[model samples]
Target: MAEAAELSDQPLFSCRNCQNPLALRSNLLSKNFWGKTGPAYLFSHAMNIIVGQKEDRQLITGLYTIADIYCCNCGEVLGWKYLRSYDVRHKNREGKFIIERAKISKEY
Candidate 1:
């Protein structure tokens, strides 16, 4: 396992356009889709069907399969992918999230 100190020391992902450090936004995690019941009901209902109804339903929030890092200078996408975290719940927690690996595209 990696150490917390090692993770924190890593640099934050930045945007390619502006060269600014990308902000971690939850909405950028995945593609938004409308559900049958309604736009708001789609995600929650989909989760239920996939994971099944259970006590930990509240805890088991849908997955964030992507991360958006932008540039500080020009506002460009630096990278994108499913972030690897030590704790799923406390992903943004200090000493938890780390850029262990990343894929930088030409756009970035």
Candidate 2:
């Protein structure tokens, strides 16, 4: 699927190694962003296939802690899931699934 130049409509993603369905095209977190850790190129409001654990280091956003996410099936490092604190803005964006495009199987 990655060989194609354009992405498919309503694309459903999978883990590149195990083919486990992850997120959809609509789940993209919008604009790609770079952080101190690296880059979170995509984000989804929800992703059932990903599992994460809290990390000690937090990001630039106060009350916005990050967790490392991995594939439930293959145990491959996916991206991250943000666990927001009491801050209103941070709470609003909680449960977002930030991902790395290259790590996920592309649909084209």
Best by TM-score: 2
Candidate RMSDs in order: 14.9, 5.5
The residue-by-residue lDDT of candidate 2 on 1-108, one tens digit each, is: 672324345686778788767776676766466544566555655454556667545556665667878788888887777766556766756777776766667664
Considering every candidate listed, which one attains the maximal lDDT? 2
Candidates in order have lDDT scores of 0.27, 0.66
Backbone clashes for every candidate come to 17, 1
True-structure lDDT of candidate 2: 0.66
Q: Which stretches of candidate 1 lie over 4 Å from their true place?
A: 1-64, 84-108
Give the lowest summed-lDDT range of ten residues in model 1: 41-50
lDDT of 1 at 14: 34
Residue lDDT tens for model 1, 36-90: 2222101110100111111211113444434433333453333222233345664
